[model samples]
Structures are given as C-alpha cells and as structure tokens.
Target chain A: MTENRDSIAEIDLLAYADGRLAGDPVRRAAVERHLARDREAARLVADIEAQNAQIRALYDRVLDAPIPERHRDALWGNAERGGGAWMRLAASVALFALAAAGGAAVGYHARDGIDVPSSLIERAATITPAEAGDATFALASTGRERVAGETVNLSFAMPDLSAFGYRLVARGHPDPGAPNLVRFLYRGVEGKEVSLFMRPRMDPGEERVSTRTVGDVAVSYWSAGPVAVAMRTDDPQMDGIAVAKVLKHAVDFARVSVPGPLDEAAPLDGTGAQMAVEAEAGTMLTDIHAGPSQLQ
Target chain B: MNDDVKWMVERQIPHLRRYALALTRNLDQADDLVQDTLERALKKRHLWRRTGSLRSWLFRILYRTYVDNRRRWRPERMAADPALIDAFASQPPDQEHRVEYTNIAHALDQLPDEQREIVLLTAVEGMAYDEIADVLSIPIGTVRSRLSRGREALRRFRSHTEGAAPLRRVK
Candidate 1:
C-alpha cells in the first residue's frame, strides 16, 4: 500500500480536496483513481468534510456584525498630516542650538588658519552627499548676517579653503521639490557674495550630471561620485567649469575619505541598484535614501 | 472605496465575529480581534492594490492578529460545566445538538493553534486553498498538508470522546 501510495502526489490530493487544482487533468485523474480504491483515504476525505462543515457552522455569524465607525475616521486622521507642527518647531529650535554650539567649537579654526576639527567635518558629512541626488550640503561660518530680509545665522566652523579658489558661503534652504539642489553661499573676492547650486544632469543608464541657469544664478550640476552637487550663484559670468572647480575643492576639503571611481566601488544592494536604474531611466532623482526614520 | 467592499464588510462582519468567537471562544476577545483587524485594514487600504479578494485580506489580518494576541496573553479557559452538558442532553435531538457542538468545540480547542487556524480558515470560512495560502503567507501545498493533518486530529478527538461516553441521561 505504501509503495502504491508513492505514486499519488500529496499536493494534488490536497489541491483536489481544496478544489484549487485546475487544468492538470492527468494529476487530478490520478488522485481520483487512488481515492476510489482506498477506504482509509475515503475516511480521511469524510473527516475533512465534517471538519469543514463544523467550521462553517461556527464562524458564519461573524459576517453579520456591524463595522465600527471609529476605524474609518482614524485612518483618514493618521494619513493626512506629514508631522505635527509642534514637532517641526521643536526640531528647528534644536537645530539652532546645535548650530550655536558647533559655531563656538569651530570659532578658533576660522580665526587661525588651522585645519577644521574632525567633528565639524563629520557633522557636515551628515548632510546628504551631493552625488546622492537632490539634497543640500552646507558648512556655515560662525558669523551672522542678514540676507534677503531674513536674519541668517551661521554656526558651523568654516574651513579656510580660499587658497583652493573656493569660498564657503552662507547656507540657504533648497527649493522644495527640486530634484537635485545644493546651496553653499560664500563671500568671494572683494566681499562679493556667491551661492553655488548644483543639480545633476539627466542621463540614461547613468545618473545625470548637468549644469543649467536658474534665474540669474549659474548652477554647476552633476550626478557623479554617488551625489548630486549643485552650486548656484547670481554671478552671470560664472560658468560650469568655474563652479565645478569650486565645488570639487570644497567637497574635497569637507570629505574625510574620498570614494574611489565607480567601477572600483562595491556594487549597490538590491534597493540601491533599483534607484540607480531609476536614475538611469531619467526619472527625476527623487530622494531614495529617506527611510522610515525620516518620515517626518 | 467601492460599495462592494462596504457591502461585503457589512455583510461579512457577523460571519467574521462568529468565526472569531469560535476561534477565541470568548465573545469579547472575538469582537476585539474583529475590530483590530478592521482598523488595520483601514490603515493599510492604500496597499490593497485591488489584486486579490478583500475577504482574503481581512481574514489574513484577523488570523495574524489572533496568533499574535495568543502569544502575548495566555487565554483563560472556561471549564465545561457538567450542568450545562446535562441541560444540552435534555434538549431534543432535532434541535441543533448543543452538546455535540460543544464536543466539537472542545476537540478543536485541543488541536495546536496552527492546526486550528488551518481548520477554521479552510473548513469553516469556506476560503479557497489559494486564499488561505495568501492569508497565512504559506504555500498552497503547506496549507493542504496542514489541513489534512488538522482534520485527522479532529476526527480522532471526536471519536475518542464519543466512545468514552454512552448517551448519559439528564439529571
């Protein structure tokens, strides 16, 4: 009996029992043939039927109960708000305090032409990398000044990279919904102010690295080195090469360990590879790195 | 979003509660489980994607919540009262045999939680094997095997209990 039982595919019997198997006439017939002769199998089938009957009798009443109204109301309530306003205000205040503390720490570095502290560089590194898509990275000077009718305050210790022909600028907020935007404001020669906004170029099978004009600002934009760096400035004469030179120098100064060329770097994981493919597909470089913690 | 979903949920709540009652054997707990499942469904409505039947999704939530709650809190078992059994026996056979139903319930209670779930989802709820698979996140093959084993266990239990007791007279 056991030897003959080996011929019966248990899954087919189960599926036949559950009524899920379809279009496989051969296997279905095989199971039916075995069931016809086997008394124990017949008994097993009866038992299953009885159990099913019992279960149906037990739970058929649940279908008639009323759905509570509160459940639907809660769903809409939770979904619409991005985050509470109080939380956002608290975060802004906390950020200001952190900036003040950071500025005091980096005050000596700016006064004396010494290397910026490692902590300051690391703090700046926390800002999304420019190659990572539309996000801004800024290293604000400890000095405060009014800009565009708003009193802009700086807190981070600025690196004196004037020798490299790149000046650190007053940090400004990036435009919401910009695919790739980075703002770094700095006082250039003769106290002239400049802001760098770099946005990555759109490309296929590769993340875009490009430059374009935004209003009066000449932006140097590129998607290379796993970040999108955008240097935006009001200077009409400033071109891509000059902006790129300044960005490269500033990023080099800020980056603790520069990554090697793309080919040498480890391949991206499944999610990262998917984002890279999307980037190559010319989908506007959406912020892919924002995970659950950044939901607010 | 459709009237069909609203209609289905409205029509199916009683059945869901009855099944949940059978599963939990506690009226309050059963209702709580049903409520929790509905709340979860409402929150995750965006993920519905209109791919599968809504009942399967609802059942999946109910099953998972029941399993999780069982793990978190030990259920309080109600002892079978001899007087209640006597009263059930005094009732006419033509009436739904409360004693027999209680016997079946007791037998179901003895089965492992996983086996009991398979039994309830398949036998009681009239869910397709594919629907059960989707609800439980198990393969169809596993569902079949589990269902077979669960039925066999139930049969043995019912038979053993039946053989031990000749029809006792009501006091």
Candidate 2:
C-alpha cells in the first residue's frame, strides 16, 4: 500500500486521473507506478475512469439531442429586445436631462425672495450656511478670476437662520449629536462636489452661530430658537464671514417678509405645470447624480 | 444577433441540460437550474467581455446556482430511492459491465455535496483541475484533493457493495 507513497502526491494522482497531468510526464509516471503497486490506488483510478465514462455516456447523447425550443426562443427574444443596451442608453440620457433641470430649479428656488445677482446662482448652489438658523439671512456673492484664459465663477450663499430643520441620509446611522442635521452636497465645475451640513445647537437667549473651515471648504453653523443653520463654501476667493453676513440677511428676510417697493406680484399662467416640470427636473438630476457616471 | 453566439447556445443547451440532470438527478429541477443560469448570464452579459471562455462562465453560474439552491433546501439526510437505484442497476450491462457503473452512480449520490460536486465537475463534466478550480472558485490543490477523496470514497462504496452481493454481478 505504501510502496510508492512518497513517489506520488495525492494531488498529482487526482490530476493524473483527471487527465490534466498528461503533459506532466514525471508526475504521470510516478502515479502510474503507484497505481500498479497499490490496489486501493488502482481502484481509485478505475472508479474515476468509470465515473468519467458514465458521465460521457450521460451527456454525449445530449450533443445529438435537440436543444429545447424554450432556451433558443428566450435568447432570440433577448437579442430582439436590444439585449438591454438600448434601455441603458435611454436611461442614461433621461438621467442627464433630469440632473440639468434639477440643478437649474434648485438654483432658482434658492435664489427666490433674495436680492442676489443672477450671475452668482451657480455659486449660490454650492453655498452652505453655517449655524442652524443662518439660512434665514442669506445672500449671494460672486468673484470671477481668470484661470488659464477661463473665467471661473466663485459664488457663495449665506443663510442667517441659526435654528433650521433638515434631513440626513447616510450609508450608516447618523451620530446622536448631529440629529436633525443633514448634509448637502453638489457637483461643481471641476468634477468635484462640495460637502457641508448643519446641526441645531442652543446658545443663550439670543441665537448666534459660528463658522469653521475644513480643507478647502468652510462650514458655518448657528442655533436660533428652534432653527439651526450650517453652510459650506469651497470657494477660496470668497470670505466665509462675508457669505455668513449675506445668509443672516436672507434669514431675516424669510422671517419678516418686509415688502419692498419693487416687490410686485406676478400673474401665474399655470403654477401646477411649473411645479410639475420642476419636480420632474429634480428627479432627473437625482437619477443622473446617482447613476453609473458618478460611479465611474 | 451574432450567429456564433446563437449557434453556441443551441449547441451547448443539450450538454448543459444533461449536466444539470446529472447534478440534480431530476429532469424538472435540472431544466429550472439551466433556465436560471441562462437568465443570469443574459442579464450580466457585461461581465463576460470575452476575458475567459464563455463555457466556463456558464458553468460557473450553473454550479453556483446549484450550490445556492442546495444550501437553501438543506436536504442533507434525504436518501436516494432504493427502487430507483435497483432499476438503474438492472439495466442491461454494456460490454464493460453496467453494474459497476450503476454502483459508481449510487456511490456518487451518497457522497457529501461538496465531494459530489468535485466528482461531477471533474469526472462527469471532464473538466481539467484548473477549470474545476475556476468553476468552483477554489484553489487547484483543493480541487485535486477533493477529487481524490471523492474517488476513493466511491471506490470503497463500490467494493463494499460488490462484496455484499456477488451474484448481482452474474446477471
């Protein structure tokens, strides 16, 4: 039983039985010798050979047997349906259109009831108000600097509300201290998005807030009454304090709603249609931001 | 519709079905497994960007699906029907003696699922050790070891059965 034990590795014997070791002459010869000397090993080889023969018999007939019509039909059906390629392409186009529309709508709504420059809407979209309630006193400011012959619009949004409410969606459970605080992020011009969020905190009778800068982005936060405010700005050229001041003003405007001489009511042709379009645009933008493009 | 792909699918189905039948030992279950494997391959065709052989990918899906279903069912103690075994054994012996082959099949049914898979893939499917490794996502050494163990077990089972019934071999 042990005559050629050292000469034949079990793995080599298996490989030899499988016919994979046919090209390896040394191992093959060793296994053959071991098989000759050992009855158990020879039986093992015979069993394997028999099993192989039986399997061939079982399946060799299938080569001549007609392929079931169902399988062929399904494959053809898939091919006729464009094999999911066209569907994916259509989804991608729909997603891109949605993202563009969503971005524009969010920019416009965020600009409403504020006296910010129209050119600064793109920058305002990236602004994150520091302190919870600071969003109530918001403003937009833009600084353009020529970078390699291209003018880059650096904009910021300042919200004055120290106490504000927002939702948080994260891959993991949110921290207890950051309850009711949510982060907002937006992809910007350079293929990079700014990250910022707000959490409500209490400070004395009068609600006041503070701001801090993390990496290239600035985070400002405050707690006022029941509201909390936090704004993030990644623009290097714009001052976080200046943006905070504008946000405070916007918050005050949201609270008091003081009517100005230029504040005239405009007639709406179809407010429902406008809202639906805006909603659809938002959905599309969300899809695009979450699609394969972002993953790539 | 690539004619080559169509032709390949048409040709491979019978082989795939036969392999499925051997694995499941039931026609309906085998067809269901084959269908599921094909559906998955079609959905994830992007993963098959001609990196390796298509047959390997298909077999991998089939093997994984079978394993998953087995795990879900957990029919560990279910015994093969003695009547079915006898029926298979009583079939006319080929020139090489069919009784031995039926004993092998019965022994294979008794093997542990992992060992049985190794036997079927290597012996039944005629896959190389490396191909078995790829299909099972195991090291080649593991495949070899499992095959050896499976073969040894089957041989022992056959020898024991033959010793018990000497007259069974006469007819």
Candidate 3:
C-alpha cells in the first residue's frame, strides 16, 4: 500500500491480482515475493477478488434469465412486419420528414391565440381530426418543403422510438387556417398512427409538460428550452405521460426556413381512422426571430 | 448488417443484460435499457464497424443510456454506512452465498456511480485496466485512481467493523 519504489504500488498489486502481470515476468515474481512479505498486500488482493466473485454471483444469473417478450419481438419480429433493413431505412426517412414538416406546423399553431413555449402542450381546443381530411402534407416535388412560394428547411428532433414499439409513418398539416403547417406521424406495431406536432420556441421559457386523452387518443405535450412538442397515439399500452417525460429531453427543435410558402398535407393510415387532432404547428417557427406578434 | 455481425450482437445481449441488472438493480428497467441499446446499436450498426472491441462499444452505449435515464430518474441509493460492515467471503460458506451476496450488493449500492461502475467492471466483469478505460472513455490512470478509491471505500465493509461472523484469514 506504500508508494515507495520497493513497496509495491496498489495498482501494481491489483494488476498482479487481476492476472495482468504477464507483461513482465521478473516484475511479476518480484511482486509475488513482495506479497509473501507483505500481509496487507496479499489480504487486499484476496478481498478484491472476493468482491468480484460476489458481484458475479449476484447478477450473472441474468445471463441465463429469460429475455423479455418486447425485446424478443423487436429483435426477431422483422419477418412478421418487414425485414430489419427496410424498417431501419423507413425509420431514418420518418426522422427526416418529422424534422421538416412538424416544425412549420407547430410554430403556426402556437402563435394563434395560444400561449406557446409553456402551455403549448396543455391546451387543445379548436383543432380536431374531423377537419384533418383536407390538409395535404404534400411532397413539394423538389425534395425540399416549400412554404408560401419560398423553400423552407424543417428539422425535427426525435428520439429513436423503436424500443417503445413505434416507427415513423408520414407527416400532415391539420389546420383549416394554416396551410403551411406540418405534423409528423408515426405508426405503432398495430398500425395505429401517432402524430407528433412541434414548434420552435420564440421566447425561450421554463420547460413545461402535460398529458391528456381526448376520444381514446392519448396525447402528451411538453415544451423544453427551445421547442414544444405534442404526440398522440391510440395504442392502449401507449402511456402518454411516460413517453412525454422521456421526450422532454429526447426531442430536438425542428429548424424551419422559408424559401417559399406552404403547399400540401398528407393523410396517415390507421385503425378505422379515429383521427387524433393536433394543431397545425410548423409555419410560425420562422417567426421566432420575427419577434412578438410576427406570426399573427 | 451481415449475418455474422448480427449474431455477434445477439450473443452479447445476455452479458449486456447482466451488467445492466447490476447497474439498475431492477430487472424490468435493466432489460428496458438493454432493449434500447440493442435497437439503437442495430439502427446505427455501421458506426460499430471500426471499433476494436464490440463489447466495449456496446457497454459504452449501455452506460450512456443508463446515465441518461439516471438523469431523468435516479432511484435512491442506500447511503454507505461504515457502521454496518459485513464480511463478503464468509467463513464456512454455504452453497447459496445468500448472505455474502446481499451484503456486497448493499455495499456496492452505497458507493458513488462513477466508483461503482469502475469497481463493477473491474471486479464483476473481470475487465482489465485498458478495457475499463475503453468502457468508461477515461484514461487508464483515471481508471486506476477510481478503482483504488472504490476498493478502499468498499474494503471498509469487509476489512473493518465488528460483525456476527469472523472473516476467514487470507494468506
């Protein structure tokens, strides 16, 4: 335990104990001879080994324990759904669409008589799925989203949702007033669509999170630091509150820039089309630098 | 991407699960962490291509996810009480190792996360100093320092305190 030259350093003794002393035989023998004289060093090595044995004894059983059903499904369920390669590719594409479209839509929704940045995830009154049919979450045909004759870049911050049994499907803009708004949609294992609506915070405020269920659609909304996001899904097992908590730190603010104005909205496939209504949220993000009342 | 690499990943699940269980001490949460790591690793499988050690890469992701969850929800750890020291390698040991296991698990939970992880990787997984460095993304000297600190902290439970049974004398 002493630091002196002849006195073996603790780490050297530990290395000797861990059997990493093979690097130098002379040093290893010297350390062993040192241990023969030093009772403390020998005892210390034994205790360290004992601790290791005890830990292995405690948790190594998990090596033989049954893998969980959900994880198993995620790993090998590719055949039933699709190949893992195809699903992963689809996941990346879903991420890109959410980044662009979901941003423009949420920004516009928060600016309209809505107290954004804080309560953006709490209040849900006017927007409904009944009106969601007409909005075309259209591809601008140029590979970039265009808003009002100017091409806009939308970036969405989304965490990988595969572990939670979800994948990205499509995006939509569900507002009668704002055609430029965008919303990204996700499909659960059961083919139910989970809509994610996001808008960048114009005036950064304290983070807020809240969950509510309307018409069997569980919605979780949270605004943290730079952006506000809302996600709604119909899966009975989908715990909106839990998902929102994870997402509060998980989602990144989508970046929206206007090279042009809004064009189209898309419809998502679901179970019997029990559409979950979320605000058209992407357009007003450009207004973050446009100052207060800019989007109005 | 290929079958061989896919199989290699699948084989590490049980080992990953064990390390995770030791970290969280909860079966469900540990498995959830494992699930998340596997999904993310597979999704980003290309990144793992050039790494010299797959286990190190996988474990790095595991602990990273564990700490992320810890930031959101840190399950309260039992404070290390120097008063209630117990022997880990019992005298006249039984087959189950029940008493020794509980005492050590409790002792381990008391150490700080950084130290606990270093100790567990070194002790439980039998990882060498270099592998510990890779797993933690820390310098080897730092790993040694943390290990020394952790061992001294944990040794109190085994080396000190007056308890029911006497520790078997080690030569």
Clashes of each: 46, 57, 42
How many times do residue backbones clash in model 2? 57
Worst 10 residues of 1 chain A by lDDT: A269-278
* Model 3 chain A: ten consecutive residues of lowest lDDT: A271-280
Mark the 10 consecutive residues where model 2 chain A has the least summed lDDT. A270-279
Candidate 3 deviant stretches above 4 angstroms: A5-7, A22-24, A79-296, B76-96, B161-171
TM-score of chain A of each: 0.26, 0.24, 0.38
- Give candidate 1's fnat, 2 decimals: 0.27
Summarize candidate 3's per-residue lDDT along B54-149 as a digit string, tens digits: 667788888888887885425445212222112212232353344555567677877888899988887666666887898788899898888888
| C-alpha lDDT of residue B28 in model 3 | 65
Task: Quantify all predictions' global Cα lDDT against the true fold.
Answer: 0.45, 0.45, 0.54
For model 3, how does the per-residue alpha-carbon lDDT over A76-117 read when each residue is reduced to its tens digit? 555343445434534332311111122222211232333343
Task: Name the better of 1 and 3 by lDDT.
Answer: 3
Cα lDDT of model 2 by residue, B1-171, tens digit: 343344444445665776776677655677788888787777776676444445677888888888888754343331244333333332444644555555656677788878888788775565667767888899987876777777778767877877854322222
Model 3 clashing-pair count: 42
* lDDT string, candidate 1, A127-148, tens digits: 3333222222332121112222
